[model samples]
Target: MVCVFAIALLLLGPNPAKAESREQAVDRLTDYLFYRVNSQLNNRKLQTDDREYIRQWQRLREAIDPRVKSVQEVCLRVSPQEKGWEFTTINGETYEQTYDRLADTIFYSRHPQRTGQPIPTNDKIGISEWSAIRREMFLSNCGL
Candidate 1:
């Protein structure tokens, strides 16, 4: 019986030294948070909001080397802003601008008007632009 239990444990458990890396764990957590929040907010949610959220988790991922053993530690180290999470835009803008833009798109259908300029449909946010895209966010909002 003891031998059988030992075998089961060996097969089921993560190897101690080769356990999940912090980045993988953080990615898993980020995915779960994104899923739960988007499920609740439904169509009212913008997928990009997870950007800042993942950044926070990545900070935690950097801070801690070991796999998380308790929710308390994670909670202590990371918590969402009581208000909208701070985020910026191509120009200088706060999370409020994103929120207002979202509102205009959803509630008012007046999203086309941005600072008296029509929303540029030609702008494509691609992988090559992520560095520049996040540069403003990293400089202005992300404390990390």
Candidate 2:
């Protein structure tokens, strides 16, 4: 009985080095993108620059790295701004952000170019972009 259980475990357990499927890769990338956008939204709303918030944001940003290994990776560039930072992804996507300390607001934009102009919108932009990307990913490969 012990031998049979051990055999079952060997057959059923996950392998650490196995490659991810295309569907899984797409789903993971979609989820990571959403999480990254959501983290920015949270960071924009806080009244104070709490340490925990920064830590959480960093975690979410880091999570994106592992997913990139499953797909074709491109260039990622980051530039520090006066108030925030600009991030550009491999897929021709760029995020430019700025914070208005006096108004306590965050403004940002998403575009395909590295030096793309920001739309100067609020946090709701993140939600809208997330939904659009989710829908596109779902239709592309995740739905299959």
Candidate 3:
């Protein structure tokens, strides 16, 4: 009985691995927003006016803003894939944006790049602008 209790205590002991801090969480949320915005833009088969795009951007901003304080200082890394893009923030969080051009569907996954580097490709997409827009939305919604 004592041996079983000792083993359980060892299993329940505080994990040595450090959990992600709050700043890391904020960065992750920012990266996710960026990927989502890019995917949405790429998958809109019908040409959307600036106003409609802005509305969509606002919705995404609202969805992620509450979880983070500031987006301006967020550092982003973007890599274009065959069908879309993948993004990561300086805090080590990552996400992917895949656009189904045929079906006009946008798929987003948080931390899709956690296990490996993004696939190599030469496809160029408007990554900087998307990152900027994400930062702006985050700042506006979070008052930062």
Candidate 4:
């Protein structure tokens, strides 16, 4: 469904006359993608053990990596697959974006209200790494 919607958007092109706001587009895109990923995670959790579940989650990146880059190009106008493209997010907040941040905005919202979100990635960071980043940030911010 998201792919179909994305494809429709690409085919239709920007309707400068009466288009939805950019912020609305960003929220719709990210929210739809996040919901899909999380829904898959929930289903995978039922069928696999912890290690396997994490593996499946990370494997998702391999498939989505391209679609995401396409979004950056077609929908986002951020240059095709440009790793450092930045953009505004849902709540009038913005981030100096990278491929990872654009893909993981849900996990790293500018005004994130949750804590200790499990970092999901492909051949990249994991719980241990997230823990280190979390603790290091805490200590660095409250330094001696």
Better of 1 and 2 by lDDT: 1
Taking the tens digit of each residue's C-alpha lDDT, what string does model 4 give over 19-128? Answer: 44544544444444444545544433234455543443343333234332223433434455343212323333333223344334334442144334645555264444
18-132 per-residue lDDT for model 2 (tens digits):
5556445544553444444445464254336655544433443353343343212222332232122112233433322111110011112233231234334664765565444
Ten contiguous residues minimizing lDDT sum, candidate 3: 98-107
Model 4, 58: alpha-carbon shift in Å? 22
Instruction: Supply candidate 1's per-residue lDDT for 13.
Output: 86
Please give the lDDT score for candidate 2. Answer: 0.37
TM-score of each candidate structure, all chains considered together: 0.23, 0.25, 0.23, 0.25
**lDDT-sorted candidate list, best first:** 4, 1, 3, 2
Model 1, residue 104: what's the lDDT? Answer: 29
Q: For residue 115, what is the lDDT in candidate 1?
A: 31
Q: Which stretches in model 2 have alpha-carbon errors above 4 Å? A: 15-19, 39-144
Say which prediction, candidate 2 or candidate 3, comes out ahead on lDDT: 3
Q: What is the C-alpha lDDT of each candidate?
A: 0.38, 0.37, 0.38, 0.39
RMSD of 1: 14.5
